[model samples]
Target: MNIIKVRITVSLIFEKIFGKLLKGHERSIQAKKNIALSFLFKGLSITINIILVPITISYINSNRYGVWLILSSIISWMNLFDVGLGNGLRNKLSQTHAFKQYSRSKVYISSTYAVLLIVSIGIYLLFFLVNQFVNWYAILNVSQASIYNLNEVILLFVGFFCLQFILQVINVVLTAVHATSKVSLISVISQITALIAIYILTLFTKDSLILLVVALSGIPLLVQLIATFWYFSKQYKHLAPSFQLISFSQAKGLLSVGGYFFLLQIGSLVLFETDNIVITQLFGPNEVTSFNIAYKLFSVLVNVFTIVITPFWSAFTDAYTLNDFQWIEKIFKKMYLYWIFTIAVAVILVMISPLLYRLWLGNLAINIPILLSIAMVLYVAGFCWLMIHCYLLNGIGKIRLQLMLYIISTLINIPLAIYLGKIWGTAGVTLSNVFVFLYMDILLFIQCKKILNRNATGIWNM
Candidate 1:
């Protein structure tokens, strides 16, 4: 009897192992398919931008390009208005969907859109006023000592740009609702239109620098806003703007979630862009150009990975809602390994980036390869951790924790980066990123482990 029982147990164990292997393989394949589609859109965008870099460089000088980079970076800081509401909405929607609370889900979704639109408009007006009054020429480090009257042009561009950003936020909300295919289509169309506008502007205009920047920045936002509103209006008739107000109580819920995210957003902007600002101040505008070039290249790699991982936010919500911890763990492990591999490849590409830059942009001032490699490694690791933590926290409706971690990391990063940059230059600034990410990742890991332990203990007792 003992011999028979042992043999049966071994057979059962083997069967279970085989079943798990098959399931894992299937899940990985599905994940890859999703990743591939996301990557296709991202890759196309990156390729187009890469091809344009040389064309733009040939037409406009490096100094103008550096200014454009600075202005764009400043505008990117406006993402603070997002305040994590998109992810918070997605989290709530996912949870609601899991619970079959469709009515509540719609209310949450509508209220989120309402709040973001109002906040976005306010932020835009604030920026507009600042741009109008601020003597950016005095503040900015441009190659030409004279401040070109770009404030009016930049303000106009940013105003339209803000509208576009609001539309994109709506698109993100749509994406959270599992409308990524539509989002991808809209993005491609908008980008193509914007590129064509830039090309035409470049061909005709004598003032290529200003014209190109305005066309590149302004047209797409306008096009995207139009397209997004049209699409969303058509599909979700209820999403139309109306006086159907969100109660203060509901507003408080969003603010509660978003407040933390706002800090995180601020911290993120400071952490990522502070180096360029410091380099611009300490070194010069030319160094900014070199750093921007390398940073742009690194950004492409990070964006590609982000596109792949983005859809998982909604999927994670679904899994969490179903009490599927095992599935979550499996996906997380796969993503971690994939990130390691992806970052390795990114580092290798960045190692050869200087050679590519020399061939493409002539002799740049900074060591492109080293800066690119270090920044690539730091950004990939840091961004990966940020994304993973955000998704995990969002799934659990723990936006505050995510915000706290980012705030702590950002606060630490600023002083550390400033100190390091003073000592080592751009490379030292890049190294500080590794430290920031390491701290956040360690904290997140500990927190996640504790959550898992409690969850597991509860399950075991049940």
Candidate 2:
């Protein structure tokens, strides 16, 4: 009787262990599938963008095109308003979803949407006020002949720009809700349509660059908003916000989270986008165009890696919420290896960047090999740091530390970039990024290690 009882107990234990292993295996497979799908969409979009950029640059002279790049960079800084709301909401949703807390998930989603909408309105107002006072013409270094035209068209462009920014927040909400495939599809189609429309419009209105840019840029957001509304209304009817004001408690949570994320965004923008401004201000708009072309081409590799990792963010959040330290560690190890491999390939490509640039743009203005190779290395390092930070800190709600690191880094980036740009020109500016990313990464890793260790201990105790 004792032997029979012992055998039965051991069998039950083995079965339970086997079941868990099976579930983990299944989850790993699902994670890979999701990552691949997300990567496919982003890869296609980037490929299309690459094919179109040369044509666009050719149509609009390099100087004028550089102005576009600078304007876009300025707009990229405006993403500070997103704070970290998308990430915060994603973490919350992943946790709630894991536990089958459907009602709470709906509330969280609605609250996040409401908060983002309010923040978007605030950003719109800020943009308007800045537009009214700021001398965009001087900043862009527009020729006297073009200055009057730029001033006349600035307000109209700002309006369209604000509309596009609001749509971006809505798109973020869609991403948090795991509706990214739909968003990605809409993004690609709308962008292709807009590109085609711009090409057609240019034939008739060759001189109306501002109007062309505004129309082409704004129309895509309108399409995205329509797609978002249609999909969310049908698929997530329960999460639909009534547009009523969110409670103070909910607002506070979003803002507190977003404020930190906002700082981080500003820091990252300072590190990445400030280079163009510094280069243009120190050298000229032509140099800006040269740098941007090389940077964008090299960024294809970085962006592909980002797209591959993004879908896994929600999964990391879910695992963190469950205190699954083993799974988290395993995932991190796999991702680290993959990132290292991807970056190695990017470095190799950088060796041929000069040839690639000549083929793409015809008689490059800059040393594409040096600029792209340095930028590629900096970007790859930054990408690795970002994945670890997002998985460990952002996934688990330790964003305040990230915010602190970003603030310190931003303070460093401004002076360093300006000083470097003055001394070495564009190369100096590009080289400074390596230092900035390294500083931030080291700080983040130290903090993350402490958090992971503590959590691992807790998991073991549990």
Candidate 3:
């Protein structure tokens, strides 16, 4: 009788702590599904990326591969030109959906898509013309011989990239509706398609860089475009992006909300995106590859943590709408624990990085110093920590702190990175981010607390 009583007591204790018996909580259930699906898909995406690096390096020479990374970095900035409309729409749609205001959601969706479509068309034309005057060789800091059909490569990539910013709203909508699992499902399929295209190119093509670029950019665009169409046609017919549904009022509203996000985006672009450009300008394209190789290896852990936080972005919004401060408080306590756990994971990742890099890249593996590895680990952990609150801030559309802090960080980041890159090479570039994270982690935590306490006035005001 005593043994049975002890066993029952332990089981009850475990159940209460783990919340297994309390799985009926709506927010928890949504978070659990989102986490599972995101991991499943992001896992596949990460695996494809790991394999792509080696095969792509083999297919294209080192110089060309480095140039491709630069091209990707450049195009990534184009989305920021949306001026934060996509993210604004995400939070807006989440709020409107929670209230069951489906018409407002459709208007927001239609207006944002209309704006992006116009922007995409104009950019496609602008880049097409600008490609003539711009010296790709000088911009990328690559030898002329290393680039074959330079104009064609830029044009094709820009074409796909411009379309991606617009069509990717499908994902924004899915995420807003808290159908994050569906978003992951779409991502996994897109990644698989792109991977298969690259594998085909590797086998059949010789030294055709344009063909490789086409496969990499074009195939994914085709996949995402199709998926976007399929979703709108079937599951989201009401929120479909018809030009007729576009509203100037909704556009103004998105801009009003997205304006801050746009500023934050600019700050982030400077702070984070400039690393490759700085590396290329100072160290060279080959060095950029070395930096990227180490980053990709360790970024796997960061990416996994991101999968956990991403689904919660809109979930936090839903919870906030319901005024469930207790739930938010509990979830945040759990997030803090995970942030601590991430440090241990980062340490483990840095320690094992050597053998992992060698086996993954073999002869092509670059020498990653221990300090650089540690810096990268620090950067990723800090990023994961900030994200725990960043998502909440984004969820509620209150990001003044993010706006001001990121601007300050970006102003400090560039010169600091260049100065450090000169001294420590790649490690210095990674270390520049540590300073940004320090400010972000502290301020965002405070903001989360203030918001939870319902004292979100003054500095915490929208």
Local distance difference test, candidate 1: 0.67
Name the top lDDT candidate: 3
Count clashing residue pairs per candidate.
0, 0, 0
Candidate 1 C-alpha lDDT tens digits along 1-462: 999999999999989765654555433444455565666776777777776665665556566666667777787877666676765666666666556676666567667667767887887778767776777765566623433667865776677666765666567655666555556666666677767876776687654655776667766776677765686578755444444645546656866766666676787797777777777777766667777777677787678767767767777777766767787777778778878887787778777776777776664344464754676677777777767756666667555555676777766887887788788777777778877877777766666665555552331221
lDDT of 2 by residue, 210-329 (tens): 755665577777787787587668876665555553454765676666666667677778877888788778877778887777777777877777665665666666777777777777
The C-alpha RMSD in Å for every predicted model, in order, reads: 8.3, 8.6, 3.8
Tell me, by TM-score, which candidate is best. 3
Q: Tell me the lDDT of model 3 at 345.
A: 84
Q: Tens digit of lDDT per residue, candidate 3, span 1-462?
A: 999999999999988755852485687777777887788889998999999898888888676778888888888888787999988899999899888888888889999988888889999998888888888888888877777578788888888888888889999999998888788888878778878988888788876778887788878888888988898899888788776889988798899998999998998888778889889999888888888888898888888888877878988999989888888888888888887887898899888988888899889746667788889988988888888988999898789878889988978998999899889988998888887789888988888888999987877756
Query: Weakest 10 consecutive residues, lDDT, candidate 1?
Result: 453-462
Give the worst 10-residue stretch by lDDT in candidate 3. 16-25
